[model samples]
Target: MNNQHETPEQKRERLRQEELKKNPIGTLKDGFNGNGNLADLVGSLGWKGTGILIVVLIVGYVFYKLFF
Candidate 1:
C-alpha cells in the first residue's frame, strides 16, 4: 500500500499488475512491441478476419458520423 515501505521486487510486481490491468485487450502491449499498425495487426488475422474487422469499422464510423 505504501510505496516507501515496498521492497524493490514488490514495487516491480505491483507495477506489472497495474500494466496488465491497463491493457486487458493486449493492444497496448502489441503496439509497444512494434505491431501497432491496425492494418498489419488485422492482416495477421487472415482474410476473413480482416473483412470482419473492416466491416465493423465501417459500420462504427457510419454510426458515429450519424450520431455525432
Candidate 2:
C-alpha cells in the first residue's frame, strides 16, 4: 500500500470539494424565495399605500424637526 501524500492536483480537487460542501448553490436559491412574496405584497398595496407612507414620512420628519 502507498502511503504517499496528496499531489497538487489531488490537493486542488480536495479544496474544490470542500468549497462546494461549504457553499452549495441550492441554499442561495432557497434564501431568495421570500423576496418574491415581499414584491407581491408591495405590488398589491397600490398607490394608496404609497401615499400613506409618504405622508407618514413627512409627518415623522416634521416631528423630528420640531422636537430636535
TM-scores of the candidates in the order shown: 0.43, 0.38
Global Cα RMSD, each model: 12.2, 15.3
Worst 10 residues of 2 by lDDT: 35-44
Q: After superposing candidate 1, which stretches have Cα over 4 Å from the reference?
A: 1-40
Using TM-score, give the best candidate's number.
1
Candidate 2 pairs with clashing backbones: none
Stretches of candidate 2 off by over 4 Å are: 1-42
Report the C-alpha displacement of residue 66, candidate 2, in angstroms. Answer: 0.5
In Å, residue 23's CA in model 2 sits off its true spot by 30
Q: lDDT tens string, model 2, 1-68?
A: 13267888888766655644666453334334553343333333446865786799899999999999
What is the C-alpha lDDT profile of model 1 across 1-68, one tens digit per residue? 88999999999878755755666357544744785665335534547866887899999999999999
Quote model 1's TM-score. Answer: 0.43
